[model samples]
Target: MISGETTLDVRRRLPGVPAHVGIIMDGNGRWAAMRGLPRIEGHRRGLEALRGTVRAAIDFGLDYLTVYSFSMENWNRPIEEVADLMGLLKRFIRNDLGELHKSGVKVKVIGGRTDLKPDIRALLDEAEDLTRSNTRLTLIVAFNYGSRQEIAAAARALAEEVAAGRLKPSEINETLLSQRLDTAGVPDPDLIIRTSGEKRLSNFLMWQAAYSEFVFLPMHWPDFDRHAFETALAEFSARERRFGRVTAQGQNGKTKKI
Candidate 1:
Protein backbone atom coordinates (compact mmCIF):
# COMPACT_ATOMS: atom_id res chain seq x y z
CA MET A 1 0.00 0.00 0.00
CA ILE A 2 1.07 3.61 -0.52
CA SER A 3 2.40 5.24 2.60
CA GLY A 4 0.58 8.13 4.22
CA GLU A 5 3.35 10.44 2.98
CA THR A 6 2.42 10.06 -0.71
CA THR A 7 -1.28 9.50 -0.28
CA LEU A 8 -2.11 13.20 -0.21
CA ASP A 9 0.21 14.36 -2.99
CA VAL A 10 -1.58 16.79 -5.23
CA ARG A 11 0.30 15.42 -8.22
CA ARG A 12 -1.53 12.14 -7.79
CA ARG A 13 -4.92 13.75 -8.30
CA LEU A 14 -7.19 13.70 -11.33
CA PRO A 15 -6.68 15.09 -14.89
CA GLY A 16 -3.67 12.81 -15.40
CA VAL A 17 -5.01 9.68 -13.76
CA PRO A 18 -6.21 6.98 -16.15
CA ALA A 19 -9.99 6.72 -16.15
CA HIS A 20 -9.81 3.00 -16.93
CA VAL A 21 -6.94 0.67 -16.11
CA GLY A 22 -6.55 -3.02 -16.96
CA ILE A 23 -4.22 -5.39 -15.22
CA ILE A 24 -2.66 -8.67 -16.38
CA MET A 25 -2.13 -10.36 -13.07
CA ASP A 26 0.70 -12.82 -13.71
CA GLY A 27 3.53 -14.76 -12.03
CA ASN A 28 1.64 -16.31 -9.16
CA GLY A 29 2.80 -19.83 -9.95
CA ARG A 30 6.38 -18.75 -10.52
CA TRP A 31 6.39 -16.85 -7.26
CA ALA A 32 5.18 -19.91 -5.46
CA ALA A 33 7.77 -22.14 -7.12
CA MET A 34 10.56 -19.79 -6.16
CA ARG A 35 9.51 -19.86 -2.53
CA GLY A 36 9.15 -23.67 -2.50
CA LEU A 37 5.46 -23.37 -1.80
CA PRO A 38 2.43 -24.77 -3.54
CA ARG A 39 0.80 -22.84 -6.37
CA ILE A 40 -2.38 -22.58 -4.34
CA GLU A 41 -0.59 -20.48 -1.74
CA GLY A 42 0.59 -18.10 -4.43
CA HIS A 43 -2.93 -17.77 -5.76
CA ARG A 44 -4.18 -17.13 -2.23
CA ARG A 45 -1.62 -14.38 -1.81
CA GLY A 46 -2.62 -13.02 -5.19
CA LEU A 47 -6.16 -12.60 -3.85
CA GLU A 48 -4.84 -10.51 -1.00
CA ALA A 49 -2.92 -8.42 -3.51
CA LEU A 50 -6.16 -7.97 -5.43
CA ARG A 51 -7.79 -6.48 -2.33
CA GLY A 52 -4.87 -4.10 -1.99
CA THR A 53 -5.17 -3.16 -5.65
CA VAL A 54 -8.89 -2.45 -5.26
CA ARG A 55 -8.18 -0.18 -2.28
CA ALA A 56 -5.41 1.50 -4.22
CA ALA A 57 -7.71 2.12 -7.16
CA ILE A 58 -10.27 3.68 -4.83
CA ASP A 59 -7.57 5.83 -3.24
CA PHE A 60 -6.51 6.99 -6.68
CA GLY A 61 -10.11 7.82 -7.54
CA LEU A 62 -10.11 5.67 -10.61
CA ASP A 63 -13.38 5.04 -12.39
CA TYR A 64 -12.69 1.54 -13.72
CA LEU A 65 -10.29 -1.28 -13.00
CA THR A 66 -10.32 -4.52 -15.02
CA VAL A 67 -8.33 -7.59 -14.05
CA TYR A 68 -7.50 -10.79 -15.90
CA SER A 69 -8.72 -13.21 -13.29
CA PHE A 70 -9.07 -16.58 -15.05
CA SER A 71 -8.40 -17.11 -18.70
CA MET A 72 -10.37 -19.62 -20.77
CA GLU A 73 -7.18 -21.49 -21.64
CA ASN A 74 -6.63 -22.18 -17.96
CA TRP A 75 -9.00 -25.09 -18.28
CA ASN A 76 -6.24 -27.07 -19.95
CA ARG A 77 -4.28 -27.21 -16.73
CA PRO A 78 -4.19 -30.21 -14.39
CA ILE A 79 -7.53 -31.11 -12.91
CA GLU A 80 -6.31 -30.55 -9.39
CA GLU A 81 -4.99 -27.08 -10.14
CA VAL A 82 -8.17 -26.16 -11.95
CA ALA A 83 -10.23 -27.34 -9.02
CA ASP A 84 -8.14 -25.28 -6.65
CA LEU A 85 -8.66 -22.17 -8.78
CA MET A 86 -12.41 -22.76 -8.85
CA GLY A 87 -12.44 -23.16 -5.10
CA LEU A 88 -10.54 -19.95 -4.64
CA LEU A 89 -12.89 -18.00 -6.88
CA LYS A 90 -15.87 -19.24 -4.87
CA ARG A 91 -14.14 -18.40 -1.61
CA PHE A 92 -13.21 -14.91 -2.72
CA ILE A 93 -16.72 -13.99 -3.77
CA ARG A 94 -18.38 -15.54 -0.75
CA ASN A 95 -15.93 -13.93 1.64
CA ASP A 96 -15.32 -10.56 0.03
CA LEU A 97 -18.52 -9.74 -1.85
CA GLY A 98 -20.06 -7.93 1.08
CA GLU A 99 -16.98 -5.81 1.63
CA LEU A 100 -16.86 -4.85 -2.04
CA HIS A 101 -20.53 -3.93 -2.06
CA LYS A 102 -20.23 -1.83 1.09
CA SER A 103 -17.33 0.04 -0.51
CA GLY A 104 -19.56 1.00 -3.45
CA VAL A 105 -17.57 -1.00 -5.92
CA LYS A 106 -19.54 -2.58 -8.73
CA VAL A 107 -18.52 -5.95 -10.14
CA LYS A 108 -18.75 -6.85 -13.81
CA VAL A 109 -17.88 -10.24 -15.25
CA ILE A 110 -16.91 -10.63 -18.89
CA GLY A 111 -16.58 -13.83 -20.95
CA GLY A 112 -18.62 -16.75 -22.21
CA ARG A 113 -20.76 -18.49 -19.61
CA THR A 114 -22.44 -21.25 -21.58
CA ASP A 115 -20.14 -23.93 -20.23
CA LEU A 116 -19.88 -22.78 -16.64
CA LYS A 117 -21.46 -24.91 -13.95
CA PRO A 118 -24.90 -23.86 -12.79
CA ASP A 119 -23.70 -22.85 -9.34
CA ILE A 120 -20.74 -20.83 -10.60
CA ARG A 121 -22.86 -19.03 -13.14
CA ALA A 122 -25.41 -18.21 -10.47
CA LEU A 123 -22.70 -16.83 -8.20
CA LEU A 124 -21.34 -14.65 -10.99
CA ASP A 125 -24.81 -13.33 -11.72
CA GLU A 126 -25.38 -12.60 -8.06
CA ALA A 127 -22.13 -10.67 -7.80
CA GLU A 128 -23.04 -8.43 -10.71
CA ASP A 129 -26.66 -7.97 -9.67
CA LEU A 130 -25.77 -7.24 -6.07
CA THR A 131 -23.46 -4.31 -6.84
CA ARG A 132 -24.82 -3.08 -10.16
CA SER A 133 -25.55 0.38 -8.80
CA ASN A 134 -22.20 1.05 -7.13
CA THR A 135 -20.64 4.41 -7.98
CA ARG A 136 -17.16 4.61 -6.56
CA LEU A 137 -15.43 2.19 -8.92
CA THR A 138 -16.25 -0.62 -11.32
CA LEU A 139 -14.17 -3.78 -10.97
CA ILE A 140 -14.27 -6.02 -14.04
CA VAL A 141 -13.35 -9.64 -13.61
CA ALA A 142 -12.27 -11.22 -16.87
CA PHE A 143 -12.94 -14.80 -15.98
CA ASN A 144 -13.01 -17.43 -18.72
CA TYR A 145 -12.04 -14.62 -21.03
CA GLY A 146 -9.68 -14.81 -23.96
CA SER A 147 -9.32 -11.87 -26.31
CA ARG A 148 -9.22 -14.05 -29.40
CA GLN A 149 -12.36 -15.87 -28.33
CA GLU A 150 -14.08 -12.63 -27.49
CA ILE A 151 -13.23 -11.13 -30.88
CA ALA A 152 -14.30 -14.25 -32.69
CA ALA A 153 -17.62 -14.30 -30.89
CA ALA A 154 -18.26 -10.70 -31.84
CA ALA A 155 -17.41 -11.42 -35.45
CA ARG A 156 -19.69 -14.42 -35.46
CA ALA A 157 -22.54 -12.34 -34.14
CA LEU A 158 -21.98 -9.73 -36.82
CA ALA A 159 -21.80 -12.44 -39.47
CA GLU A 160 -25.06 -13.91 -38.26
CA GLU A 161 -26.71 -10.51 -38.52
CA VAL A 162 -25.46 -10.10 -42.05
CA ALA A 163 -26.58 -13.59 -42.95
CA ALA A 164 -30.05 -12.84 -41.67
CA GLY A 165 -30.13 -9.59 -43.74
CA ARG A 166 -30.50 -7.61 -40.54
CA LEU A 167 -27.26 -5.68 -41.15
CA LYS A 168 -25.09 -4.96 -44.12
CA PRO A 169 -21.45 -6.03 -44.28
CA SER A 170 -20.47 -2.47 -45.17
CA GLU A 171 -21.85 -1.27 -41.86
CA ILE A 172 -19.58 -3.54 -39.83
CA ASN A 173 -17.15 -0.90 -38.69
CA GLU A 174 -14.80 -0.77 -35.73
CA THR A 175 -17.41 0.95 -33.59
CA LEU A 176 -20.05 -1.64 -34.39
CA LEU A 177 -17.73 -4.54 -33.77
CA SER A 178 -16.66 -3.04 -30.43
CA GLN A 179 -20.24 -2.62 -29.38
CA ARG A 180 -20.79 -6.31 -29.93
CA LEU A 181 -17.99 -7.28 -27.59
CA ASP A 182 -18.56 -7.99 -23.90
CA THR A 183 -16.89 -4.74 -22.86
CA ALA A 184 -19.36 -2.58 -24.73
CA GLY A 185 -20.40 0.63 -22.90
CA VAL A 186 -17.11 0.64 -21.01
CA PRO A 187 -14.41 2.93 -22.38
CA ASP A 188 -11.27 1.38 -23.75
CA PRO A 189 -8.55 1.03 -21.18
CA ASP A 190 -6.25 4.04 -21.04
CA LEU A 191 -3.43 2.14 -19.36
CA ILE A 192 -2.72 -1.59 -19.11
CA ILE A 193 -0.34 -2.77 -16.40
CA ARG A 194 1.19 -6.25 -16.62
CA THR A 195 2.98 -7.56 -13.59
CA SER A 196 5.78 -10.23 -13.33
CA GLY A 197 7.98 -8.54 -15.97
CA GLU A 198 6.65 -10.59 -18.85
CA LYS A 199 6.04 -8.50 -21.94
CA ARG A 200 3.06 -9.38 -24.11
CA LEU A 201 -0.69 -9.12 -24.09
CA SER A 202 -1.06 -12.85 -23.35
CA ASN A 203 -4.51 -12.77 -24.92
CA PHE A 204 -5.76 -9.95 -22.74
CA LEU A 205 -7.80 -7.05 -24.23
CA MET A 206 -6.32 -7.37 -27.70
CA TRP A 207 -8.80 -5.23 -29.61
CA GLN A 208 -9.62 -2.71 -26.87
CA ALA A 209 -5.98 -1.95 -26.10
CA ALA A 210 -5.08 -0.70 -29.56
CA TYR A 211 -3.78 2.64 -28.23
CA SER A 212 -3.30 1.91 -24.55
CA GLU A 213 0.05 2.52 -22.85
CA PHE A 214 1.64 -0.50 -21.19
CA VAL A 215 3.70 -0.71 -17.98
CA PHE A 216 5.51 -3.94 -17.16
CA LEU A 217 6.63 -4.51 -13.58
CA PRO A 218 9.01 -7.22 -12.43
CA MET A 219 7.09 -7.80 -9.24
CA HIS A 220 4.77 -10.82 -9.27
CA TRP A 221 1.02 -10.57 -8.80
CA PRO A 222 1.21 -11.61 -5.17
CA ASP A 223 3.65 -8.75 -4.57
CA PHE A 224 1.65 -6.05 -6.33
CA ASP A 225 0.85 -3.25 -3.90
CA ARG A 226 -0.18 0.38 -3.93
CA HIS A 227 3.41 1.50 -4.47
CA ALA A 228 3.65 -0.70 -7.51
CA PHE A 229 0.41 0.77 -8.82
CA GLU A 230 1.75 4.28 -8.21
CA THR A 231 4.96 3.44 -10.06
CA ALA A 232 3.01 2.26 -13.09
CA LEU A 233 0.85 5.37 -13.07
CA ALA A 234 3.95 7.53 -12.82
CA GLU A 235 5.38 5.87 -15.92
CA PHE A 236 2.09 6.31 -17.71
CA SER A 237 1.89 10.00 -16.78
CA ALA A 238 5.32 10.62 -18.32
CA ARG A 239 4.47 9.33 -21.77
CA GLU A 240 2.68 11.32 -24.47
CA ARG A 241 -0.09 9.53 -26.36
CA ARG A 242 -0.47 10.62 -29.96
CA PHE A 243 -3.12 8.17 -31.14
CA GLY A 244 -1.77 7.95 -34.73
CA ARG A 245 -1.04 11.70 -35.09
CA VAL A 246 1.96 13.88 -34.35
CA THR A 247 1.97 16.50 -31.61
CA ALA A 248 4.15 19.52 -32.36
CA GLN A 249 5.04 22.39 -30.09
CA GLY A 250 3.59 25.67 -31.31
CA GLN A 251 5.28 29.08 -31.32
CA ASN A 252 3.67 29.85 -27.95
CA GLY A 253 5.12 26.59 -26.48
CA LYS A 254 1.74 24.93 -26.47
CA THR A 255 1.14 21.47 -27.94
CA LYS A 256 -0.57 21.51 -31.35
CA LYS A 257 -1.65 18.75 -33.70
CA ILE A 258 0.52 18.45 -36.78
Candidate 2:
Protein backbone atom coordinates (compact mmCIF):
# COMPACT_ATOMS: atom_id res chain seq x y z
CA MET A 1 0.00 0.00 0.00
CA ILE A 2 1.13 3.51 -0.79
CA SER A 3 1.59 5.86 2.10
CA GLY A 4 -1.13 8.43 2.76
CA GLU A 5 1.29 11.27 2.10
CA THR A 6 2.31 9.75 -1.22
CA THR A 7 -1.26 9.12 -2.19
CA LEU A 8 -2.14 12.73 -1.45
CA ASP A 9 0.85 13.92 -3.46
CA VAL A 10 -0.19 11.78 -6.45
CA ARG A 11 -3.80 12.91 -6.15
CA ARG A 12 -2.75 16.55 -6.34
CA ARG A 13 -0.70 16.00 -9.50
CA LEU A 14 -3.12 13.47 -10.96
CA PRO A 15 -4.00 13.44 -14.61
CA GLY A 16 -7.41 12.30 -15.83
CA VAL A 17 -8.48 8.71 -15.14
CA PRO A 18 -8.10 6.21 -17.96
CA ALA A 19 -11.22 5.42 -19.97
CA HIS A 20 -9.83 2.10 -21.21
CA VAL A 21 -7.46 -0.34 -19.52
CA GLY A 22 -5.84 -3.56 -20.75
CA ILE A 23 -4.45 -6.38 -18.64
CA ILE A 24 -1.86 -9.01 -19.48
CA MET A 25 -2.90 -11.66 -17.01
CA ASP A 26 0.24 -13.58 -16.05
CA GLY A 27 1.87 -16.09 -13.68
CA ASN A 28 -0.89 -18.58 -13.04
CA GLY A 29 1.55 -21.46 -13.49
CA ARG A 30 4.14 -19.94 -11.25
CA TRP A 31 1.58 -19.14 -8.62
CA ALA A 32 0.39 -22.72 -8.64
CA ALA A 33 3.93 -24.10 -8.47
CA MET A 34 4.71 -21.92 -5.47
CA ARG A 35 1.72 -23.35 -3.67
CA GLY A 36 2.42 -26.99 -4.64
CA LEU A 37 -0.86 -27.02 -6.54
CA PRO A 38 -1.76 -27.74 -10.15
CA ARG A 39 -1.72 -24.95 -12.72
CA ILE A 40 -5.43 -25.38 -13.30
CA GLU A 41 -6.15 -24.37 -9.71
CA GLY A 42 -4.26 -21.15 -10.28
CA HIS A 43 -6.28 -20.48 -13.40
CA ARG A 44 -9.49 -21.02 -11.48
CA ARG A 45 -8.38 -18.49 -8.92
CA GLY A 46 -7.47 -16.15 -11.73
CA LEU A 47 -11.04 -16.36 -12.94
CA GLU A 48 -12.20 -15.23 -9.51
CA ALA A 49 -9.79 -12.35 -9.78
CA LEU A 50 -11.23 -11.51 -13.20
CA ARG A 51 -14.71 -11.42 -11.73
CA GLY A 52 -13.60 -8.95 -9.10
CA THR A 53 -11.78 -6.89 -11.68
CA VAL A 54 -14.89 -6.53 -13.84
CA ARG A 55 -16.82 -5.26 -10.85
CA ALA A 56 -14.01 -2.92 -9.92
CA ALA A 57 -13.81 -1.53 -13.43
CA ILE A 58 -17.50 -0.78 -13.37
CA ASP A 59 -17.22 0.78 -9.94
CA PHE A 60 -14.39 2.97 -11.15
CA GLY A 61 -16.50 4.13 -14.11
CA LEU A 62 -14.19 2.74 -16.73
CA ASP A 63 -15.56 2.28 -20.25
CA TYR A 64 -13.39 -0.51 -21.65
CA LEU A 65 -11.41 -3.41 -20.18
CA THR A 66 -9.30 -5.78 -22.27
CA VAL A 67 -7.78 -9.01 -20.92
CA TYR A 68 -5.29 -11.34 -22.56
CA SER A 69 -7.00 -14.64 -21.85
CA PHE A 70 -5.11 -16.96 -24.18
CA SER A 71 -2.42 -16.35 -26.73
CA MET A 72 -1.72 -18.09 -30.00
CA GLU A 73 1.66 -19.19 -28.69
CA ASN A 74 0.02 -20.84 -25.71
CA TRP A 75 -0.94 -23.77 -27.91
CA ASN A 76 2.66 -24.96 -27.66
CA ARG A 77 2.12 -25.98 -24.06
CA PRO A 78 1.52 -29.56 -22.92
CA ILE A 79 -1.57 -31.14 -24.39
CA GLU A 80 -3.07 -31.92 -20.99
CA GLU A 81 -2.61 -28.34 -19.78
CA VAL A 82 -4.02 -26.96 -22.99
CA ALA A 83 -7.07 -29.16 -22.68
CA ASP A 84 -7.55 -28.08 -19.08
CA LEU A 85 -7.36 -24.43 -20.05
CA MET A 86 -9.95 -24.94 -22.77
CA GLY A 87 -12.19 -26.77 -20.35
CA LEU A 88 -11.93 -23.90 -17.89
CA LEU A 89 -12.81 -21.43 -20.63
CA LYS A 90 -15.90 -23.40 -21.55
CA ARG A 91 -16.92 -23.65 -17.93
CA PHE A 92 -16.38 -19.95 -17.33
CA ILE A 93 -18.58 -18.97 -20.24
CA ARG A 94 -21.25 -21.48 -19.39
CA ASN A 95 -21.44 -20.58 -15.72
CA ASP A 96 -20.77 -16.84 -15.81
CA LEU A 97 -22.27 -15.68 -19.09
CA GLY A 98 -25.69 -14.94 -17.71
CA GLU A 99 -24.35 -12.95 -14.76
CA LEU A 100 -22.00 -10.98 -16.96
CA HIS A 101 -24.86 -10.11 -19.30
CA LYS A 102 -27.02 -9.12 -16.37
CA SER A 103 -24.26 -6.80 -15.17
CA GLY A 104 -24.45 -4.99 -18.52
CA VAL A 105 -20.98 -5.82 -19.74
CA LYS A 106 -20.62 -6.12 -23.49
CA VAL A 107 -18.38 -9.11 -24.32
CA LYS A 108 -16.08 -8.89 -27.31
CA VAL A 109 -13.58 -11.58 -28.30
CA ILE A 110 -10.79 -10.58 -30.64
CA GLY A 111 -8.49 -13.04 -32.44
CA GLY A 112 -8.34 -15.49 -35.29
CA ARG A 113 -11.38 -17.75 -35.44
CA THR A 114 -10.54 -19.89 -38.43
CA ASP A 115 -8.58 -22.49 -36.42
CA LEU A 116 -10.80 -22.53 -33.35
CA LYS A 117 -12.98 -25.57 -32.74
CA PRO A 118 -16.62 -25.21 -33.71
CA ASP A 119 -17.88 -25.47 -30.15
CA ILE A 120 -15.43 -22.85 -28.87
CA ARG A 121 -16.41 -20.56 -31.71
CA ALA A 122 -20.09 -21.09 -30.93
CA LEU A 123 -19.53 -20.28 -27.25
CA LEU A 124 -17.71 -17.08 -28.12
CA ASP A 125 -20.43 -16.08 -30.56
CA GLU A 126 -23.13 -16.69 -27.99
CA ALA A 127 -21.32 -14.60 -25.35
CA GLU A 128 -21.01 -11.68 -27.74
CA ASP A 129 -24.56 -11.97 -29.02
CA LEU A 130 -26.13 -12.19 -25.60
CA THR A 131 -24.44 -9.03 -24.34
CA ARG A 132 -24.35 -7.11 -27.61
CA SER A 133 -26.77 -4.46 -26.37
CA ASN A 134 -25.21 -3.92 -22.97
CA THR A 135 -23.50 -0.56 -22.57
CA ARG A 136 -22.16 -0.40 -19.05
CA LEU A 137 -18.72 -1.72 -19.93
CA THR A 138 -16.99 -3.39 -22.86
CA LEU A 139 -14.98 -6.47 -21.90
CA ILE A 140 -12.52 -7.50 -24.57
CA VAL A 141 -11.12 -11.01 -24.38
CA ALA A 142 -7.97 -11.57 -26.39
CA PHE A 143 -8.23 -15.33 -26.81
CA ASN A 144 -6.04 -17.12 -29.34
CA TYR A 145 -4.68 -13.69 -30.18
CA GLY A 146 -1.24 -12.60 -31.22
CA SER A 147 -0.37 -9.01 -32.14
CA ARG A 148 1.93 -10.00 -35.01
CA GLN A 149 -0.71 -12.24 -36.59
CA GLU A 150 -3.29 -9.50 -36.19
CA ILE A 151 -0.99 -6.98 -37.87
CA ALA A 152 -0.11 -9.35 -40.68
CA ALA A 153 -3.76 -10.16 -41.29
CA ALA A 154 -4.61 -6.47 -41.40
CA ALA A 155 -1.85 -5.81 -43.94
CA ARG A 156 -3.03 -8.71 -46.08
CA ALA A 157 -6.54 -7.28 -46.06
CA LEU A 158 -5.29 -3.90 -47.21
CA ALA A 159 -3.18 -5.58 -49.93
CA GLU A 160 -6.25 -7.38 -51.20
CA GLU A 161 -8.14 -4.10 -51.44
CA VAL A 162 -5.31 -2.53 -53.44
CA ALA A 163 -5.11 -5.57 -55.73
CA ALA A 164 -8.86 -5.31 -56.36
CA GLY A 165 -8.44 -1.59 -57.25
CA ARG A 166 -10.80 -0.69 -54.41
CA LEU A 167 -8.01 1.16 -52.66
CA LYS A 168 -4.80 2.72 -53.89
CA PRO A 169 -1.41 2.04 -52.32
CA SER A 170 -1.14 5.74 -51.46
CA GLU A 171 -4.51 5.58 -49.66
CA ILE A 172 -3.30 2.86 -47.29
CA ASN A 173 -2.34 4.48 -43.98
CA GLU A 174 -2.32 3.80 -40.23
CA THR A 175 -6.01 4.47 -39.95
CA LEU A 176 -6.86 2.04 -42.74
CA LEU A 177 -4.68 -0.66 -41.25
CA SER A 178 -6.19 -0.13 -37.81
CA GLN A 179 -9.68 -0.42 -39.27
CA ARG A 180 -8.74 -3.80 -40.66
CA LEU A 181 -7.43 -5.13 -37.33
CA ASP A 182 -9.62 -7.20 -35.03
CA THR A 183 -9.90 -4.33 -32.57
CA ALA A 184 -11.19 -1.94 -35.21
CA GLY A 185 -14.19 -0.64 -33.25
CA VAL A 186 -12.40 -0.42 -29.90
CA PRO A 187 -10.38 2.58 -28.77
CA ASP A 188 -6.72 2.13 -27.90
CA PRO A 189 -6.00 1.29 -24.31
CA ASP A 190 -5.05 4.24 -22.11
CA LEU A 191 -3.37 2.04 -19.50
CA ILE A 192 -2.02 -1.53 -19.59
CA ILE A 193 -1.43 -3.56 -16.43
CA ARG A 194 0.63 -6.72 -16.30
CA THR A 195 0.79 -9.00 -13.27
CA SER A 196 3.58 -11.35 -12.04
CA GLY A 197 6.34 -8.78 -12.46
CA GLU A 198 6.61 -9.26 -16.22
CA LYS A 199 7.80 -6.13 -17.98
CA ARG A 200 7.08 -7.24 -21.54
CA LEU A 201 3.91 -7.28 -23.59
CA SER A 202 4.56 -10.77 -25.09
CA ASN A 203 2.84 -9.63 -28.28
CA PHE A 204 -0.42 -8.69 -26.61
CA LEU A 205 -1.22 -5.38 -28.35
CA MET A 206 1.87 -4.10 -30.09
CA TRP A 207 0.18 -1.54 -32.33
CA GLN A 208 -2.72 -0.46 -30.14
CA ALA A 209 -0.53 0.14 -27.06
CA ALA A 210 1.83 2.50 -28.84
CA TYR A 211 1.76 5.03 -25.99
CA SER A 212 -0.23 3.30 -23.30
CA GLU A 213 0.96 3.70 -19.71
CA PHE A 214 2.09 0.37 -18.25
CA VAL A 215 1.93 -0.85 -14.65
CA PHE A 216 3.70 -4.06 -13.75
CA LEU A 217 2.52 -5.68 -10.53
CA PRO A 218 4.64 -8.09 -8.56
CA MET A 219 1.75 -10.35 -7.63
CA HIS A 220 0.36 -13.02 -9.98
CA TRP A 221 -2.95 -12.75 -11.79
CA PRO A 222 -4.74 -14.83 -9.18
CA ASP A 223 -3.73 -12.34 -6.49
CA PHE A 224 -4.74 -9.17 -8.33
CA ASP A 225 -7.49 -7.29 -6.49
CA ARG A 226 -9.19 -3.91 -6.35
CA HIS A 227 -6.50 -2.41 -4.14
CA ALA A 228 -3.85 -3.44 -6.63
CA PHE A 229 -5.84 -1.81 -9.41
CA GLU A 230 -6.29 1.39 -7.40
CA THR A 231 -2.58 1.50 -6.78
CA ALA A 232 -1.86 1.23 -10.50
CA LEU A 233 -4.38 3.98 -11.26
CA ALA A 234 -2.87 6.21 -8.63
CA GLU A 235 0.58 5.66 -10.08
CA PHE A 236 -0.81 6.48 -13.52
CA SER A 237 -2.51 9.64 -12.27
CA ALA A 238 0.87 10.96 -11.21
CA ARG A 239 2.37 10.66 -14.68
CA GLU A 240 2.63 13.63 -17.06
CA ARG A 241 1.70 12.53 -20.56
CA ARG A 242 3.49 14.88 -22.93
CA PHE A 243 2.84 12.77 -26.03
CA GLY A 244 6.08 14.11 -27.60
CA ARG A 245 5.27 17.68 -26.65
CA VAL A 246 6.64 19.80 -23.82
CA THR A 247 4.35 20.82 -20.99
CA ALA A 248 3.85 24.47 -20.14
CA GLN A 249 5.06 23.84 -16.58
CA GLY A 250 8.34 22.50 -17.95
CA GLN A 251 8.83 25.77 -19.87
CA ASN A 252 9.09 27.89 -16.74
CA GLY A 253 5.26 27.77 -16.49
CA LYS A 254 4.94 29.45 -19.90
CA THR A 255 2.96 27.96 -22.77
CA LYS A 256 5.22 26.65 -25.53
CA LYS A 257 4.88 24.56 -28.70
CA ILE A 258 7.08 21.59 -29.39
Candidate whose lDDT is highest:
1
Q: What is the lDDT of residue 127 in candidate 2?
A: 98
Query: Which regions of candidate 1 deviate over 4 angstroms?
Result: 1-13
lDDT score, candidate 1: 0.94
- How far does residue 251 in candidate 2 sit from its true spot (Å)? 9.0
Expressed as tens digits, the lDDT of each residue in 1-258 for candidate 2 is 255554333443445778899999999999999999999999999999999999888777778999999999999999999999999999999999999999889999999898999999999999999999999889999999999999999999999999999999999999999999999988999999999998999999999999899999999999999999999988887887766787554546765546
lDDT against true structure, model 2: 0.92
lDDT scores in order: 0.94, 0.92
Residues forming the 10-long window of minimal summed lDDT in candidate 2: 6-15
Error of 1 at 118 (Å): 0.9
